[model samples]
Target: MKIYPFLKNLSLVYVLALVVSCVGDPIEQPIGKFESGVLIINEGSFGANDGDIHHYDPISGDLQPNVFESANARPFAGLIQQVRVVDGLAYIVANTGKVEIVQAADFRSVGAVNDSKLKIPRDLQVIGQKLFISDYGPYDENWNNTESFVAVVNGLQGGAVHKQIPVPSRPEGMALIGSELWAACASGSQLVVINPATEEVARTVEVSAGSPHFFVQFGANWYVYAMDAERVYFHRINHSAYSISETISIPLANAIYNGNFTMGTNGDVYIITTSGASARVAKVSIETGVVLDAEYFVGSNFYGLGFDSSSNTLYVGDHAGWQGNGQVWKVGPSGSLIDSFQAGRGPSGFLFR
Candidate 1:
């Protein structure tokens, strides 16, 4: 068929458009300076109001100090306890009874939940639009956390306190399994389960090991770790029954009660243990329920533990006695020391993107 010059040009343009559409648009580069890096939560001196956030670029090996203050033009006013990134925002729970909402990508302040009911807020768990915060409620005359509760915020973005559900003393780490919200009561031997739909305590399971502080989920089961003076106990709870199915105890001379624990990519549990002044990472096999390595990664003053499943790297934080800048040790998958980088004061937790 004979074709005019204009018609031939139109056919070429249409083919070019079709090829471009099939390939799709180019992948956009991340614009935020703090995006695509590890965020280090610095507890900074308690009550000193020096709490800060540090950003470390794993690919570039560049550490950006005080990214929170740099982005907001003001220092974080409370002791940063933990950070949970949901959607595109970071909910920073602080010991100062406040949860600061910031842009996860840029570390910019967006909103905050400063309710009086958040007495010594320890951890945060977001279920849909609700934000559940575990708090070690106000202390009594003897300086005991006798009135611990979970403060529920109605909205995800710095909403007002919807209710405060009372629970055992010293509630710490929390998790949402199925439909129930399980909270670890660090001062007592109980794992309180709350029905998020009703925002009330559904039941409490007594953990004989006591001081259940953290949890790790592997496959269809959930494991919680507790510590006593002589041993560290790992209890596997049945997801449907909400009861402990198995208990694994690992003897230890001196075990720190910090809730620094994480699950490796292989479904093994890694916890921080102390030997005199040095800190060690203990690995526990999920299948064997035995101590795989009592000293997986050893270092000094290891205060926080986080595992990056993407790279199979373990990030251990060294508080340096709460002195100047802290350090984060990067351990390889084979339990070998890879590298260490300086972070903010009292590097307590990590958030990897």
Candidate 2:
């Protein structure tokens, strides 16, 4: 009778252990505060060495400023021009001639590409294992970027310059369409296409008579916006033909010159332009080639524009004339301001996860 009770207790303990094993740890670990949110890239003052990033949570409506310097314990030197996230790392291209790489989730500085050849680097594009940096080249005696080129880095982790492919002047935003890498020369009216395999200029497609600055691809077409002394031109390029298919011009009086733009999920393009201290967003319909709203959303010194497809929201950054802290406004789909949060100095761009 004593042995019977001992056997029963042993069986109960075994069942309890089995139940504990079946109830394992959480299926997913909680993500970092900066991991699943919008990253506001503040270019900072040109000579202040205060370039930083701000994290914003759309769900909680919370803003965390200076996340980059807080995570790395050091200020990000130089003007942060643009940030591109590939795989899980963020390649931050600074105008002061370097590309700083960091973890996209935590903003930890992991590596950088500081080749001496990267002068006034503007943007970054990665294809496969190679990183292409668009540099304005060193300034001449007259301060002209006449030797602009794209520097190629072999790998992301501790990588060096593999080669420098010469392109048109002041290459800015880049896009990979089909198998070719297209770069918009911000100082010329040319869209330079490069062959990634050979790291050479494949060809140049002439756009409207202006400086091509940015590209956004929707469907089988790529939309590019260029600005000249008189007006701004939006060119729709047929990817298969590799040529400009349509050109829509916006008078300078209506929409000023700006390179910041984004394509919405509905195939519409939203561009940001500044006039004096005030900025505006112009909406253009890709199907009809018409400017839908000349001043869809207006704010003070709006310098950055991004469309979040998942939430159908528009995020605009007001740089505050580079005088102090900037602000980011979240606009609804109907062009109504939902909320605004204070960001870092010179908030010029945004990356939404």
Candidate 3:
């Protein structure tokens, strides 16, 4: 008997689990119009064409899986990266090639952008009517930097890359502070600021030696998370000086990975980190720059973290390796487990709607 390519690297014990899931159809409910729920992005196994989005309704305790393909009557190709609900449409960035736009009311396909200029779209941020996306430009055939850029889309006139603003390599997370856009250089140790009006690189702010790959905005300041450095920086941008007025740093024990950090509704910052023994979510005070609680949510094999401000709920994604289906754990604001649902292969991040 020959092993398949996707499962060739699995251990003998885990191979049985993977075969059980692959052979039998996993239970999945048809997607529906969600009144209020968290939209979970599952980055299915690589090359399995299983990347999908699931809606978990807290009110009804229903898990609507594969909402994208079910509503569109077509499978979402490539890896489902990031998703943002703007206006009435949900912009789903499928990093394998394109960004899928769907109706927020009902997970239905509205439009898509897959221009040749998009090399590896990582993140998306909306400003007024424009959509700014960071593309981690891949190395060309010659194995050299291909010049990563931020592609601008006129959301008012359908999704299309009207212009591209060149930036540093491997741009990831992005946030809008007033009229300026702050983008993190994932492979570099700096944050690039761009003027949305001019669509030009205004300036770059140097940070600790690490990849600043994630961000969250609270009030007038911006919280930039340097994943490699395990530090979250509070940057107060001064318009008059065109520089950071004040920067406060919060140190952590473990390196932050994708979907590890999120902000709470009560103005608290929560981040998931591992301490060798177990994965833990830490709550940090925004005002004092201190860890209010070190082990807010603790579990083994935890991969992602998200907070729902409306109901004060905390959602965690646990991936027990690539052998079986992943899980989305629902916990209260106090870190009590409410419920858990079976999600796709890797339930990475959540878009609370």
lDDT of 3 at 322: 63
User: For model 3, how does the per-residue alpha-carbon lDDT over 1-353 read when each residue is reduced to its tens digit?
Assistant: 98886676567658888888887977675544753677888877777857888888778888888888889898887687788877777888877757888788887776778787887888888888787889877787876545888999887434668898888777888877667898888766678899998889998887654467777677766667664446665555564465666666677668446636778865687788876757888888777877788888888777777888788888888876766789988888777888888988788788877
Candidate 3, poorest ten consecutive residues by summed lDDT: 227-236
Compared with the true structure, what per-residue lDDT tens digits does model 1 show for residues 145-204?
999999999887886888999999999889998889999998877999999999988888
The lDDT leader among the candidates is 1
Residue-wise lDDT of candidate 2 within 238-305, one digit each (tens)? 76787898887766543445477788867687877667777788887667667788788987788888
TM value for model 2: 0.88
Q: Which ten residues in a row have the lowest lDDT in candidate 2?
A: 250-259
Better by lDDT, candidate 2 or 1: 1
For candidate 1, the TM-score is 0.90
Score candidate 3 by lDDT: 0.77
Model 2, CA-based lDDT: 0.82
RMSD of each: 3.1, 3.5, 18.1
